[model samples]
Target: MDLQAQIEREGFPPGTSVIPLAEPGGQLFRATQDGGTRGLELLLTNEAVRMYGAGPSLALVLSRLRERAERGLPPALAPGVYERQVFVGD
Candidate 1:
């Protein structure tokens, strides 16, 4: 999917920024706002270790994250690069 288009449709709060990470053989993204006080590390994968293999769609995840940002909530996950195995099921 086109990540940038999804981000625009997600309507993140003003100043919010989402960027795709250049992780070889993996899909990863980062979202940040308020000068980085609030952020999320999003990893897109169809498999995870010790957990359900599939996670939510990228559009769905972006929508939820946008909702949280609109409500002034911190990211559900801490901001940073993370191993793919760390994420659980959507």
Candidate 2:
């Protein structure tokens, strides 16, 4: 299934944003909250979707989104590939 479909199927929590990166072979997704710039790295796999948010900043992604929603703001981010990490097996 396509990345977007898979994500929709999984039913990511409200206020969560999933942006597919321009890479293949274990596709990476930039998950942001509250239309923020920095997003957590989401690794998609056949079995499950893994989030690589180990630190405090990364952990705040969902929280930030919730705050945005509470304030009646849309949780949308600019559409673009976040190239902070090098894509392997591309």
Candidate 3:
């Protein structure tokens, strides 16, 4: 899948993983992902939030969402994926 195109479709940031965190059926959620990463980085959607279980594809992802929820604000979510180490493989 085309990463940049997908971000455009979802209205996510250009350089970021987590879509802006937001509750389901709510306003536009925003998330941050290290643009440096490659591959199909997952965006924790409401579907992931509803059940909070989705085949362990995003265990660490959910943890970050929890942090956002605790903040009770979208931009308040800290430790955003502004810069981080990532692995790429072929």
Candidate 4:
């Protein structure tokens, strides 16, 4: 499945925007509910997905993005992975 499809399966709210990256495993997305931006990268073997965000929550995420935007930095940054997901079969 594609990134959008994965997000849909995860049940994120609507109006989310995702941009594909040059790197095959990476993508950038913005949440519509609060304008929070996040980046994710899929690991090899599809065993894991990594995520990073500038802010902790929807509100703070948008705030940080706006600050970055105002300072001429890209809305998304070179962030360290803060989360890792591994799916387990039931």
* Candidate number achieving the greatest lDDT relative to the actual structure: 1
The digit string of per-residue lDDT tens for model 3 on 12-71 reads: 334434443333432232444343232122344544445544334244453443454344
Better of 2 and 4 by lDDT: 2
Give candidates' CA RMSD values in order.
Answer: 5.3, 9.1, 13.0, 11.3
Residue-by-residue lDDT tens digits, candidate 2, 1-90: 454565455445676666665445454556665556534554443222233423332234334433443454433334543323332221
Scored by TM-score, the top model is: 1
Report model 1's TM-score to 2 decimal places: 0.60
Collision pairs in model 4: none
- Judge candidate 1 at residue 84 and give its lDDT: 29
Q: Write one digit per residue (lDDT tens) for candidate 1, span 38-63.
A: 67666655443224332245655566
Candidate order, lDDT descending: 1, 2, 3, 4
Q: Write model 4 residue lDDT over 13-81, tens digit each, in one string.
A: 344333323334432333321243343322221112322331222223334334433343323343433
Looking at model 2, residue 32 earns an lDDT score of: 60
Shift in Å, residue 52, candidate 4: 13
Score candidate 2 by lDDT. Answer: 0.45
Instruction: Tell me the lDDT of model 1 at 27.
Output: 61
Once fitted onto the true fold, the runs of candidate 1 whose alpha carbons sit more than 4 angstroms away are: 48-56, 73-90
Candidate 4: TM-score?
A: 0.26
Q: Report the candidate with higher TM-score, 1 versus 4.
A: 1
What is the TM-score of each predicted model, taking all chains together? 0.60, 0.40, 0.23, 0.26
Sorted on TM-score, best first, the list reads: 1, 2, 4, 3
